[model samples]
Target: MEVYYSKSAKDALREMTCKLIEVMRAESDNIPFNLALSGGNTARQLFALWQEEYRLLIDWNRIRFYWVDERCVSPEHEDSNFKQAYENLFGPLGIPQTRIYRIRGEEDPSKEANRYSELIDQQLPKKNDLPHFDAIILGIGTDGHTASIFSSCHFLLNDIQIYAVSKHPDTGQLRITLTGPVILNDTPLLIPVIGEDKRKILERLLEARTATEDFPAACIVYRAASAFVFTDITI
Candidate 1:
């Protein structure tokens, strides 16, 4: 696990963009770069950067976009992760629909989960019998959850399925999320945790030495092949 501290959210995102550009440039031209993205205020900020100036630095045609998780809502819904990326990143970059693989959040939770699982098998490279994403961007919830895998839903960490259905601990809202095996695979896990609200949780995660049920975000950093965290929080 590696951490990059920035003075503000904007600076953290700028640092993240610089690293992403390095990954993009290093990718093989013969194959598409599979990128899994998470949604939140941090993601919105990152998308805005890409839309503003960073888009020119990326080869959108060689990138295939996927979501780390999605709320069970219509694609047009304001809460939809795919909607956020489409409006802010994909649409602005003129990325084609064929390169976008989004979880069908409006469908039945179980069915959508299975569908997305199959999509991962079909799209991502296989490693150790699990689909390995090239790069996975994620966010840590203030409650210590990541990718809809709340502390209350620890079974998701043991789930062998590529993707599974989850419910928000507080709202009971359904969500489709990639399981632990896929997330902890050999991929570049980029986590940008901004704001002072996340400071304590980040500290707890950093203190943990192994994958623990207490903090789902910690399990990610401990198990992922390479985890990069960019945070404005001073910790």
Candidate 2:
């Protein structure tokens, strides 16, 4: 685990985007730059920066976009992560629809997860016969969840299924999330955590205590993947 502290959230976004551009350029021939996006205020900020500053640097045609998790709603719905990315970055930057691999959340949640897993199995590179993403961008929730894997959702912590259907223990809304095994398979995972509220949970994750169902973020360490944590919060 490596931590990069930025002066502000905006700076962190730019720095991460620059790093991504370099990584993509270096690794383009091996496979298309498969990016798994997370949804939240920090992610929105990063998307905006990509649209404004880093859009041209990315080989949009060769990049395959996927989401780390999604709300079980129509893609056109206001709360939909696909909609948010489309309106904010994909549409504005003219990224081809064919290059975006979105989870069909409006479909049966379980079926949708399976469908995405199959798509990934087909698209991503194989390591030890398992699909491994080139890069996965994630965000840390205040309660220590990543993607839609909430603190109360224990089933998501393991690699049993490629995807899982979960509910926000507090909100009761359905969500489809990539399992930890799917995330950690063979990729470089970047987690951009901002704000003071996330500090304690981030600390706990770094300390590597016993896995708690409530703090699903702790499971990130199990993967043999490299984790880059970009944060603006001071410890």
Candidate 3:
């Protein structure tokens, strides 16, 4: 796990974007870059920047898009992560239809998770019976949740596949989230976080020597090939 402190949310987003551009430019492997994107305000900023100007720095066709997690909502819904990314980034850049693999959030939760698992099998490069993503971008909540895995309950953390269905304990909303073990075994992981509210959990996550079920975000850093964190919060 590595931590980078940005002076503000804007600076954090800038740093995160710069890191992504660096990755794309430096990549020499022939396989398409598999990116699992998270949703949040900072992500929205990143998406907008890429769509408006920065995305031209890399080969768009060689980059494929996936979601780290998605709320159970229509693609057109205001709360939909895919909608935010599409409106801000994917659509504007005319990303090819075949390259975008989104979770069917509007469908039944368990079935959609299974479908996404199949999609991962079909789209991503396989290693040791699991699909490995090139990058998985994430965001953490104040309550210490990453993706839909919350601190309030014991989630099914032992799944062997790429994605799983977890319900938000409070809202009861279904979420399709990439599993912990799969994330730990994948490529570089980026967590760009912001706001004063995030400071405490960020510190704890940074200090974690072992991943715990209580703090799901720590699972991302557990045995991960490389982990980079960009944050605006003070620890």
Candidate 4:
């Protein structure tokens, strides 16, 4: 695990975008670069920065976009993660609609999970019947959750399914999230965690101990792919 402590959230976002551009350029000859995005305050800020600074750094038409997690709400809803990204980044950047793959979270949660799994299996690089992502961006919750996998969510630690349904610990709202197996598959994983509140959990993730469902961020270290941690918190 590598940590980069930037001066502020905007600085961290800029560096992360440069790293992502490099990753995309390296894999340009492949079918398409797969990038999974997480939704939260941090992601919103990052997308805003991408819109202002790095929009032209990569060919948006050649990139495939996926979300790491989504609330079970209609895409038109204000709280929809897809809506946030669309309005803030994708729409402004003129990214083709075909390149964006979103979970139909407003539908039945289980059905949505199955549909997303099938969609990914069709789109992702398949080798020996397993799908692999080119890169994935994740954010850490103050509670140590990543994606919708909360502290008590046990299924996140398993490889049985590509997507799973989980509930927010406080709101009880249902959400769809990619499982750890799918996230850690042969790909580069980037986690950008900022703020002093996340410092303790980030430290635990670097300790390299056995991962428990209680600390979802800890699972990223076990991923076979390269992992990078970009943060603004000081150690």
* lDDT of prediction 4: 0.82
What ranking emerges by TM-score with the best candidate at the front?
Answer: 1, 4, 2, 3
Cα lDDT tens digits for candidate 4, 142-226: 8778888887785676757789899998999999999888777767778898778887887777775665666777765554457
Task: Return the lDDT, model 4, position 203.
Answer: 76
Greater TM-score among 1 and 3 belongs to: 1
Q: lDDT tens string, model 3, 8-71? A: 8778877877787788767766769889999978788878767766766767888889998999
**Which ranges of candidate 3 are over 4 A from the true structure?**
none
As a whole number from 0 to 100, the lDDT of residue 170 in candidate 3 is: 81
Clash list (residue pairs), candidate 3: none
Estimate TM-scores for all models: 0.96, 0.92, 0.91, 0.93
Report the number of clashing residue pairs per model: 0, 1, 0, 0
What C-alpha root-mean-square deviation, in Å, does candidate 1 show against the real structure? 1.1
Q: Residue 4 lDDT in model 4?
A: 72
Ranking by lDDT: 1, 4, 2, 3
lDDT of 2 by residue, 1-235 (tens): 7778898888877777766777687784656778899887887788888888876677777788999999999999987899889988999999888899898989999888889888888887787677777788988887778889887786787757777899998889999898888787767888888777887877878776445555677677445367778887776
After superposing candidate 1 on the true structure, give the runs of residues whose Cα lies further than 4 Å from its correct spot: none
Candidate 3 lDDT at 232 equals 83
Best by lDDT: 1
TM-score of 2: 0.92
State the local distance difference test value for candidate 3: 0.80
lDDT for 15 in candidate 2 is: 72
